[model samples]
Target: MVVGARLEGIQLSGIRKMFELTTERSVNLGLGEPDFQPAQHIRQALSDAVEKGYNKYGPTSGISNLREALANGARKYRSDITANDIVVTTGSTQALMITAQYLFNPGDDVLLPDPGFVLNVPQVRIAGARPLMYPLKQEHEFIPQVDDLEKLVTPKTVAIYTNSPSNPTGGVMSIEDIRAITQFAEDHDLWIVSDEVYDQIVYDREHQSFLGDYDKVIHINSLSKTYAMTGWRFGFLITKAPIIDKLSILNYYTIACPNVPTQHAALAAMTGPQEHVKQMVNEFKRRRDLIVDRLNRIDGIHCLVPKGAFYAFPKYDFNISALDFAMECARSDLICTHGSAFGDAGEGHIRFSYANSMDNINKGIDIFEEVCEKIKG
Candidate 1:
């Protein structure tokens, strides 16, 4: 018998290698990474830190100043957090894993949205827990239904995973929706692991989170999207004292600590001039509007204008599988992620990332239109 079970066929390296192979000649839009570089101030901060010999390992949780900046940033959404309740992780990915590891047991059920972030479901499974999916209807703009979520809970349910300004779908759950879910979790005594990495990139509406109202919420965010610091791998998690302590101990054994230089860079990003972030969000909004309008005009494609984030999840009329459509687009030298890669509920949809230059966005849409027209014919 196997001594221990390992998570099979779930390596990020495999996906990355496939992406690298396809991107060599393709106009790649398959990644969630921002196309922009970190701001000059952030780069200078990291350089200065390196010059000053700030390369030594810091605390397992995070450096003092960076933790303070993270706490300050969290106050905008919910003012209940302090540095003591924060654990700076390598990225939101690690934060999610730590939460799953500590909160879940074998055969425990963790609820996640259908068509959710692909890695999250597998992460729950790898943590020795069963993943229970709750459907987010297209008619509802892909927002989580509180009633549906409430129905999925059982004694085996340990936590619920939610992403606002959600991946692939670009769905931002409203404040009221968040309140309902949090109340349900509170009533059920379950943990709410919310991924708010795209919280600052919202377009039409304000971003909301449950960290302020509920103590059982574990909020994870990063500087990757908003600050264009994906390569920096800097993220932080906020939870109540007990959960923070639990995650911190697991983090200590997993990665030991996040990079010192990246921590300094994140501090600069949090405390730096707000103008850069505003510029990026404004630019993304422009791209988003352009893409949504163009997609709406196309035959057989129905796209909901996203309120937050830089993605457009649009349904196509052709009965072909989402993977087939995505592959067809890739064959046409235009790259986008297939909805089915997210989950079964994602069938008949495709995700378009607008994290490219305006010129690329226009060209990419043209290519997509041409390919789609051919298919319709």
Candidate 2:
């Protein structure tokens, strides 16, 4: 039997399989998940929920308490959001899926950065929409050029997906850039899906969010990175009432509801001590400094220090493809993701995640340097 085109064409799992095949006893630095455990208070809250019999199905949009907490959290960063505007989902992934499904009709075009998150493009395609690519330039420090975005917009453009402190590249869009994009989206009546998963991981400047300026902005965020609650599968979408209602309906039919325990856990994550988050950010900063310093010293490797996310996307001077370079690194027992896994524009780079321990980061860089030298020689 022939598989569905959407299912057959998706290559994410293939990338995972490649990592599995090539990775040896080497340190695997490709994963972007936080190395820290969920905070003690959050875990205790989950345990307390279980003890209190909160294991039943939650409200489809998430538990009411969690929604309130998520809304409160959003208000700290952006104005004009409330509990009524929030829909808690399994993760930011589900939020993105629901947004795409609700906003885009078949044949509509969804704009995304060229070296953007791989999942966004396929999700748009699976929603029966065309994924229009907008190139983010290395010369521009990987920030999306508003001019390029303007060129990519079409009459059928329904939404533009942006990741600030972006994955792989770690480029954080400035407030000015965000203002221009929001103005453009407002002019064209397009939805802005801002994935702020790394919002808390920013290093240089305070994070700029589209929600502060546009009511139509759909802000997707999670406790996954900030609170080290990845396996808890907790995330929420912040948008206006009408959009929330639509996503809630789609969310109801899809998963019915997020797990009750996870909702309780997420509530704790929102209300719990924020010092853990600060500490993790500090550690990631240290690791970023270490990695950027080492990678830049390598003969043919040039890396830009990441401003936000815990990733360093570095260009390598070798004839081998990014995929092949990643494979070669794996043979040396050091696992890193090829930039091309994100998209075609990512071809000349490799993404090294600093979400690992300092020891692992140090060792991984040493191994990566050795591999690069061997290839260069």
Candidate 3:
């Protein structure tokens, strides 16, 4: 009874739970970060910043130069964007954490995607809002539609979270999908919380962001995935609202400020050579192709080729629950996520991250195939 009612139903993330179950022999596909090291120039920049004494507390809204650079990058999406639009945080995770709390009220409803990131549900709940899940059907290529939202929205609905190159499923929303969803939100007068953390890890085609399409968007991004600086934990939030002064004050009370040297390194990351970023994407593409092709060769599995991100989410014609299928894979010394860990829409699927080396990906798939055979019986 001592615990807050809002925290009552919340539990640990199923993704991290699978991760903790990893054994020394486990081929870990359960986690969600790149295996690549921080690029050479990025590392050098952090060293240089520390040597020059950037170790003290810095700006709460992030370093001015980094903010300017991010604003410049985002300006391509919206012409009027400037340094005033950014709020730097510990990570995109925190960006998400704070944004949900800032936007939602005690009784409001926020539409979310089913088979979406696990964090969306808890974040909204803790912020005292109800999460209304809209489905992304495989028949529709795992994209969200206005038709789906029609049933979910009510007068209490306040916002919707949009993820492109979505986690687990690796489904990217199309231009048409983006425009329609934006128009729907406009019609309903709801905030659009857009998470585009995997924006740069895309394959084959350019990924268009959802940020520029609407005025009510609260856009999120970070250096964690793009520069392989996950440990550095740098992220920023963007909005046209003059409310950043208020958000930064909240960020100051909440996170103090992002690490000083990491901010310096982030500056170099945005300004450094384009080669390392390109190389990382190319490597992920190789892994993406490898995992999808091999998983398809497994008789009962069907994986859609992901156009972006480092994940391969495949549906299998198995009688077992996704959690049980994942548990079976764990027994074989391989680790990946159960699809339902995302939501009910994900029940028959499993998610394999291709962020590991090719050797490990192959080894993981080999173990997964054995699990498939066991389930077939």
Task: Give the winner by TM-score.
Answer: 3
lDDT by residue (tens digit), candidate 2, 110-219: 98987887679888988889989988778899988878888889999988999998987999988888988888889899889999999999995798887785677888
Q: After superposition, how far is residue 208 of candidate 2 from its true place, in Å?
A: 0.9
What TM-score fits each model? 0.96, 0.96, 0.98
Off by over 4 Å in 1: 1-4, 9-18, 21-25
lDDT pick, better of 1 and 2: 2
Ranking by TM-score: 3, 2, 1
Candidate 3, residues 164-208: lDDT per residue as tens digits? 989978998877888999899999998899999988878887787
Clashes of each: 0, 1, 0
Off by over 4 Å in 2: 1-3, 13-15, 22-24
CA-only RMSD, every prediction: 1.7, 1.6, 1.1
Lowest summed lDDT window (length 10), candidate 3: 205-214
Residue 367 miss distance in model 2 (angstroms): 1.1
What lDDT score goes with residue 47 in model 2?
A: 96
Give the alpha carbon lDDT tens digit for every residue of 264-292 in model 1: 88888889898988899999999899999
